[model samples]
Target: MTDEEVTEQVREDAEEQAEDAEAETETEDHLGPTSTKLVAEVATQDANLATELEGHLAQLEADREEARERADELESKLKRKQADFQNYKKRAKKRQEQMKDRATEDLVENLLDVRDNLVRAVEDDHENVESLKEGVEMTLKELDRVFEGENVEAIDPDPGTETDPQRHEVMMQVESDQPEGTVADVYQPGYEMGEKVLRAAQVTVSDGE
Candidate 1:
């Protein structure tokens, strides 16, 4: 075939192809407005799904932040509890130590008055008999000063005061006109230091009843 004839045939084929494509497009358009609206609706639904997914992600992030804050609060409370327990233990230990020291001091205080009596007895003796007594008296006085410095008081019960079982011990009850339940005489003095009572006085109670 001639070149011009071949060229013309190719052109005709291309025109028919274009016409077929246009016909197919026209068929889709003829399906009506429902087809166009459906496609637009599908796009709108996709947008809505994207928005809902983003909202869920935001909610999950908020929940995670709240959980973290709660964990911090719990951790703070635990630390405070530990500190308070430590402080309480320290206070208890200090109180126990103070009680033990008080007990030891009471023992020392009770013996001070006895030592003083022995010193006075020997101090009134002659020089040859006084050397040993003088040495003992000095030692006893020094021991008493040590007790006084530690706030240990030697309690000597007076006869006029009403007898209390906590502070006085009755050795013998004798008939008298003093009172029915009062201490008649203090045989041995009691000792008290601060708020603690070391020993009760050995006393004779009046049997006025």
Candidate 2:
């Protein structure tokens, strides 16, 4: 071959190779922007999802904290109520004891005057047995007055009256001119206050003889 022909062929081949390289570069450039855009969108979606998840987690934490606070408030209220009830019970018991003591003190104070009169009667000298008996009767009348003021009644059943098991205690069965199962005589008078029997009447029952 000739030297000129060889040089021309080499130039043609170099030009075709440069044209192929340019086409490939153009194709890469066209695809590059779309691929980069898709990657960027995916990254943006992941970031939004992470932010939403963080928000949900924060709300859940807030709700849990509120519930804990409510429970603590309820527990505190229960403790306060229990303490109040215990204190009320103690106060009620103390008041009851004080009332009982006051009642006893008042009763003793009233009985003191009656005791003084009895002592004076015993210490005084009487001219005769009748005078002594009169003094004793007066003292007994005073005692009866005191008993009446206190609402204490005597449970002395009359002869031939019906025997009361609630207020009368049968001391002995006696042959008497009265109905059977009836009170013959009251041996000892009983005392009662209000609805309560302080002492039952000791009595004898008739045998209908």
Candidate 3:
């Protein structure tokens, strides 16, 4: 080949090499560095997601533990409350029984005094009937005072009063000048405290006049 031909071929080969170098630089810029940065970003995002997930799991566990502790505390309180209620019930029952026993003892003690007075009156050797009557009357007066102090009332209705079934017991029907169904006579007086009737008054209800 001539010199001109060799020089022209060499120039064409140099231009082709330059174009290949530019294409290689563009491919490296688009694929190598950009791809490496995208991969690093994906790895960082994955790590962050893992960290957030661990935090959520830990919080859930802590919440579960707190709930269990609260439940235990409430259970303990419930047990204590139940025990207190049972103890209160027992105390109230015992107190009620004690009050009843005390009331019965007081009543018996008062009745014993009356019994002693009667025994003394009976055992006295005074042969005079008037003296015996006076002793008995005085004893009765003392008993009446005791009854009054103890809030005991005598049920001694008048003979002309209307017979009350609630406070009076009719022994027998009797003919009298009073109205029918009226108290003709009181056989025995009753004693009562408050609204309680110890015994009803014994009376004879009058028939028609």
lDDT tens digits, residues 1-209, model 2?
Answer: 79999999999999999999999999999999999999999999999999999999999999999999999999999999999999999999999999999978877777787788788788998889898888888888878887887799999989999998999999999999989999999999999999999999999999998
Model 1 C-alpha RMSD to native: 12.8
What TM-score would every model get versus the actual structure?
A: 0.54, 0.63, 0.60
Candidate 2 deviates by what RMSD? 8.1
Q: How many pairs of residues in model 3 come into backbone collision?
A: 0
lDDT (CA) per prediction: 0.83, 0.93, 0.91
**Model 1 over residues 30-144: C-alpha lDDT tens digits?**
8768888899999999999999999999999999999999999999999999999999999999999999988777766777666776667666556675776666777678767
Model 3 stretches astray by more than 4 angstroms? 1-68
TM-score of 1: 0.54
| Cα lDDT for residue 24, candidate 1 | 94
Alpha-carbon runs more than 4 Å astray in model 2:
1-71
Residue pairs in candidate 1 whose N, alpha carbon or C atoms collide under 3 angstroms: none
| TM-score quality measure for candidate 3 | 0.60
When 1 and 3 are scored with lDDT, the better candidate is 3
Best by TM-score: 2
